[model samples]
Target: MSAILSPRPLIKENDVKATLLSPDFLRVSQPKTFRHSIDVYLKDSNATGNIYFARHFEWQGICRERWFFECVSADMLQSLGVFITKEAQQKYVSETFAFQKIDCEVNTFGVKHCSFSLLFRFFVGGELVAVGHQQIVFANKEKKIARLPDHILAKIREYEVEKGE
Candidate 1:
């Protein structure tokens, strides 16, 4: 398949805000393949409501061979951090899967776009485990990002399963 016809643009970076408002669709990345994909939605932090992002994984092949992945830009991370308190972080760590560490990189995706690459590390106990990455592009550099993409919602689902399930 040609790159132009690929499903890459199914979700545009600019649509990050609207997608979170009400996302009825759940797009899953191909399962068990070396190439994986995810979508996450972010809800309003100041609002009095609860919106969660979830993903369902289809496991296959060798036990240790298959792993899931996800990523978020630094801008998204900071915006989320405001709402993700220490307590929330603790709860996230305890209730969800292991969060080993997050590695970040910033660069221009193309001549027309600036992007942030986040490498997420998943783990069990003190040992290292799965890994995922996200590439966020700032298509419109002039626009300010108060909210972020929904692709993270799907990533959170897998995050809850970083450890054996």
Candidate 2:
């Protein structure tokens, strides 16, 4: 039997930060139309206390520096399903299949109209593709749940959030 190969490593911390600092990552644009809807739940379990918002459907899988917080919930993590795999994340950071956006807004509280990006690296038909400079935002006070179909949650559960010391 053949063994599986691992995805490429994430971009170097220095390089990633450098990329973020460049003028290329600084420009953001407001979309002409809304894309996706992300539901938010407050820590109090009452939706009324906090505001939550998601990118209009048009923004997903597009930006490089993607982030989700505030209304961040296990359900939100679960919604990503298999798409949140380690390999997928590696692919994302490595710019394999790049997703990027500009001037995005998530207006609830803390995270008002923040700029974001995401990068990816992946293999297709045994060939490599690197997608770079992707970004997105989730309004604070509002939580976003990625909403995945059943069966996919199994893989989603393996994902974890990292905190800085």
Candidate 3:
């Protein structure tokens, strides 16, 4: 068997920051949409009541799962294998608070032999709050990197094309 290489970040940190700051960042339409409501208990706030930085990732997880099921069938995903996050990065634009309902728009940004990238835009009350990028790899039961199934890839492409319409 050949050695597996780790996935690299598709965008540099500086580029991510620039993209997040752009006026059109949140304006870009994504193929898949997931909505989430922030609860008081999820707030890992300091004395000043600002949410902890890490909580953003947890919210991303919620959206990710929803996006997966929405775009691809859960049964198909289970039959193929598990998708693992090879790398993830987030850039926060504005502070978010409890009781805010956010819309997470996600798109299959890119695809490779063994992995794919998902870009997420978090919008709260029409304001951009944060942007997240995740590189996910499909792994078989043996935990070895596996190629994406053709059916799944086709579904992703369909969504991408639909988004452009």
Candidate 3: C-alpha RMSD after superposition: 15.9
lDDT (0-100) at residue 53 of candidate 3?
A: 77
lDDT of 1 by residue, 1-165 (tens): 654577577778778766765445455543222233222223311133322212111111111122321232334444343221111011113212212221211111111113333233433343433333334333223354333345644433333321212
Candidate 1 segments whose C-alpha is farther than 4 A from its true place: 1-113, 141-165
- The numbered model that scores best in TM-score is 3
- Candidate 2 residues 1-165, lDDT tens each? 997776865677889999999987987642221122223224312234422112222233432113232222334443333222112222221221212212332211111123222333233333443222223333323343243333432222222111110
All candidates' TM-scores? 0.22, 0.20, 0.69
lDDT of each: 0.29, 0.30, 0.74
- Lowest lDDT block of 10, candidate 3: 156-165
lDDT score of residue 135 within candidate 3? 84
Scored by lDDT, the top model is: 3
Q: What is the lDDT of residue 78 in candidate 3?
A: 75
How much does candidate 1 score in TM-score? Answer: 0.22
Q: Which model is ahead, 2 or 3, in terms of TM-score?
A: 3
Clashes of each: 10, 45, 0
User: Model 1's lDDT to the true fold?
Assistant: 0.29
For model 1, what is the error of residue 99's alpha carbon versus the real structure, in angstroms, after optimal superposition?
Answer: 14
